[model samples]
Target: MTFRTLLMASTAAALLAPAAQADVNIYSYRQPELIQPMLDAFTQETGIRTNIAFLNKGLVERLQAEGDRSPADIILTTDISRLSAAVAAGVTQPVDSAVLEENIPAAFRDPGDQWFGLTTRARIVYASKDRVDPAEVTTYEDLTDPKWQGRICTRSGTHPYNLALVAAVIHHHGEEAAKTWLEGVKANLARKPQGNDRAQVKAIWAGECDISLGNTYYMGKMLEDEEQQDWANAVNVLFPEFQNGGTHVNVSGIAMTRAAPNRDDALQLMEFLASPRAQALYAEVNHEYPVSPTTEASDLVQSWGTFTPDDVNLMDLAALRGTALRLVEEVDFDG
Candidate 1:
């Protein structure tokens, strides 16, 4: 079926489903399958049915367009900027859940309780096991050193993942310093910034570059894919700090919709997600770090040596997105 048709169908189903069903309608950027396991567990535990309408783009616009009629109770998405964008668009409401406050770290959630982060993936270095020494690249700042010139690979600077990292740089150091770091990293690019995180690892395997920046979970993902296992084995996941801070990280988060029809159920699901069981379940499903301090990452994820996550509140990094993009453009990072 066409996407619009499916969206309308999901919306209609949500609108028509009996309230007695005790269901929570979710509009998620996360694929349904990726989260279905946890949703199933929620249903098994609380008897609350979960319905999700997955959308790749225009999530904020769709919620805004639907206005008070939006059937969405929760917004499930990745990245701090997208979460902040929904808040900025007036589409999400502040949730005052004590459970959420206690479960998620303050740095991972909105200070106003507008959104709660579920999982975090660090932006880290993937170095050639054969060519690069683990101790050589220990911090984000070291990637720009002259010794590593023409030895890095990355995707587009304009992508949200990279932008978030750049935003973190702006948070730690000043703007000029962040820009110069961007420039230096750009100068050191093996080719131009031109592929996804996995591709960068493949580049490293092919001897295209010695090291690249990628989220920590990509290592697990690569290892699971038979074709990519070789690529995965070629590199060691290295968590890089911000010189003055810890490793830069980003989150996949959820928030309540302003016009939630099932507010109580939504809050129930939200609270359930913050529980230790759900936190670990979700983290294991995605091969990521759980945001709840009480929960530990899956064994596969923990095998990747741990590092401190940056202390800056993600909302602070979200605020710097505009400046980060402008800096990327000014540096002609791709040029």
Candidate 2:
């Protein structure tokens, strides 16, 4: 069936489902399968049913269209950009919860408490084990060196993941320097920016590029896929740092919608997500680092080695997104 048909069906199902006495409705950008386990646990623990509609794009517009009558109590999404946009668009409301404040680092949540990051994934380099020396690529700036010309692979510059990384570069080094670095990396491309992070690893396996940029969690996902195991095995995950800071990171976060019909239940679910139990489930299912300092990464993710994450507040990254996108266009990085 077409994706549109499936999406409509899901939306219909969500709208038609009978509401429980205590329930929360979520409009999520996260895929259902990845989040269902946590939702189930929340329901079992709190007796609060959850109805979710997964949308790949246009979440804010949909919420805006529904206005105050929207059934959506929460918005669950990946990347700081989306969360920030939701707030900027006035589709989400500030949440005041001590549980969120205690479990999540201040850097991972908005100052106004509009959104809270549940899990984090670093934007790290994936180097071909046989072809690239790990010692040679220790930092993000190293990718721009002339020696690595025609050695890097990446997705489109406009992709939120890459933009967030570029934004961090801008955040640390200033706009002009970030632009130069972006152009240098673009010049070093093994091919025109294309495909998702995992595809870049497959490129390494095929000898298409010596290295590529990808999230830390993808390494775990690739290892679990039988057909992709060789691709995963072909590369060593490298946690590259900023020249003066730690590795760049991004998040999958949650926020309460402005028109939350079930405010009490929604707050309960939000607090539950920040709890140790949910954090552990996120690590296991999503291969992401939990936001809570007390929760450990899954063994598979832990085995990938560790590095200090750049302490740059994610809200700063969100702020520079426009400049980052403009720089990407200025350089025609994808071209």
> In TM-score terms, which candidate is top?
2
Candidate 2 accuracy as TM-score? 0.97
Give lDDT: candidate 1, residue 248. Answer: 93
Q: Using Cα atoms with residue i matched to residue i, what is each candidate's TM-score against the true structure?
A: 0.94, 0.97
Per-residue lDDT tens digits of candidate 1, residues 162-197?
Answer: 999999999999899999999999989989888799
Regions of candidate 2 where Cα sits further than 4 Å from its true position: 1-8, 16-18
lDDT of each: 0.91, 0.92
Evaluated with lDDT, which candidate comes out highest? 2
- Model 1: residue 236 alpha-carbon error in angstroms: 0.2
> Cα deviation of 256 in candidate 1 (Å)?
0.4
Q: Give the TM-score (vs. native) of candidate 1.
A: 0.94
- Checking candidate 1 for backbone clashes, the offending pairs are 150-188
